[model samples]
Target: MHEPIVEFQNVSFSYGSRVALQHVNAVINKGDYIGLIGPNGAGKTTLIRVLLGLLKPSSGNVRLYGKNIKEFKDWHKIGYVQQKATTFDATFPVTVEEVVAMGRFAFAGVGRPLDHHDRHRIGDVLKMVGLDKVADRRVGELSGGQQQKVFIARALASDPDLLILDEPTTGVDVRSQHEFYHFLHDLNVHHRLTLVLISHDTDVVSTHVSRLLCINKTIMDHGCSIEFLLPSHKHNDVKKNEQIFKRVRHKH
Candidate 1:
């Protein structure tokens, strides 16, 4: 069995009187690629914040790599790419290499210059994401798709074991979306990196991610995508299940 990388035990969170998450429980195992889907205002982002330790759960516990979140200090082992991460000012003068170098600052001290090893890691991640040729180009010069890769490269520069991306392809072109997902597949298969992709593109997500986690304030469903897509033994039951899933996955 795969080891658990993240575990939420009876996790619940609230904003004053408003409950964002209630009694949420789930386990993300190593080498699992999970697609998180939900409608708007479904507490998806809140769940992520709680997992990342950005928010304290009102009642429950979270564990990272078998240690309580409060005691887990190996943050560099996880990489996060936020929504529309490619929307930076096009006129920014930073080079791709420089931007990727930011990921190393966590290993290298803040305000401290990157050493030889840091520079090597930056080059490796740029090549891994196929951005080596454009390493010297200004970030603004790249297409939206390429800019998105730059952020992914930045995340990988830390050699993180787990990667979490939130709506990564928000405004990219169709072709870029294809390329980005292909790279993600490669990373998961070849590198054995655990991945959590939060997206609303149910059609595309179902095809790529191995597991599906559907939520709306709480977990509506969680299982292999194949289980959700394939028909059950009884035809009527299959139709009924599909209808229920459609309702939960309403357009967001």
Candidate 2:
């Protein structure tokens, strides 16, 4: 069997006395599109933070590419697209190309200038995300969806093997969300990019993600999306959402 690309073993975390995560264990294999879904305040963000090495687990371990996350120094191999509200700098005057180029700074060493290869990669990423036409536009001037795409492009500019996104489709129109997911699906199948996504839209998530993880302080459920759609589990509101996703997916 192939080794897991990301794994959490009995991981737990808390903010002061309030426990946020409790003995969570999961393994994400290569090329898996895993969806994390739950109601608000379910420690989804905390889990993502642990994977990113931004928050150390109070107990247990997080491993990336078969190594301890703390010992993994090559952060560039893991791309991240945080919630739009968390990272966008609206007043920044940088162009889309400039913003995407920032991804290389982590590898270029401090104060080093971008080389021709870096510029070429930035252009390629912009084109891949359909933002080449606006490459010269100031990032602050773009629409919310465009800005979100630029953020995704920036993450891809690093040529990461795995991409983690937190609520990537938020605030976008339905069409844009569909386009983005389609793009991600192609990236996963064609480029073999492993994707880990967290979203509140359970309906849409069920349609695109191969596996679903319902998290609320701990993992409520973790398995293939088809298991979540079984008739025995189809009565709850959340399950209804999953059924709707199945129907919509079939229609497409």
Candidate 3:
């Protein structure tokens, strides 16, 4: 079997005395588009934080690209588009191009001048997100959907092997959501970029993702999308019991 791009082995995490995750073991292979789905407070965000190295597990191990998470030096290898309302600054005067160029901050020295290569990279990313015409427009001036695309463009500027998105379609119109999903499909299929998406729209996500991880406190299920969508045998048993109860009531 091919080695996984990201691995979590017997991982556990806690906040104060409450356990957020418990003995979670998962492996994500290269070029896999995975959907992480669960209700609120089910530790979806916690898992993402752990993967991003922002939070450490209390026990067990997390490896990225065959190295310990702590030792992984290539941060730019993963692109992240956080929940729409989390990081966008409506009052900021930065233009769309400037926001997209922010992805290069890690490569460019702080307070140092940008070179020709940096400008070209920024331009390329802007065009990729279809924001070239609005490159000079202030981010606040654009619609919510446009702003979301800009954030996506910013992440793509780094040309990451994997893209992790947290609720990328939140608060957008139905049409906008459809467009974003098509863009993601293109990125994954045409460009071979892996995607890990955390979303509440289970039906929509199931259509695009190759696999599904149903997380609630821990991993409830991880497998092909079809298996994830099918009602489990346990659920079928419950339905059978309900039917028996209805028959008994009608006969009485």
For candidate 3, what is the lDDT?
A: 0.79
TM-score of each: 0.87, 0.87, 0.85
Global lDDT for candidate 1?
0.84
Q: In candidate 2, which residue pairs get closer than 3 Å at backbone N, Cα or C atoms, i.e. clash?
A: none
Question: Given candidate 1, what's the lDDT at residue 182?
Answer: 94
1 versus 3: better lDDT goes to: 1
**Model 2, runs deviating above 4 Å:** 85-91, 221-252
Model 2: how far residue 238 lies from native, Å: 10
All candidates' lDDT scores?
Answer: 0.84, 0.82, 0.79
Estimate, for each residue in 88-203, the C-alpha lDDT of model 2 and write its tens digit: 67688899988888887765766999999988888888888899999999888887778888888888988899999999888878887788889999889998999988986677
Q: In candidate 3, how many Å is residue 87 off?
A: 6.9
RMSD of each: 5.4, 4.0, 7.5
Q: Cα miss at 42, model 3 (Å)? A: 1.0
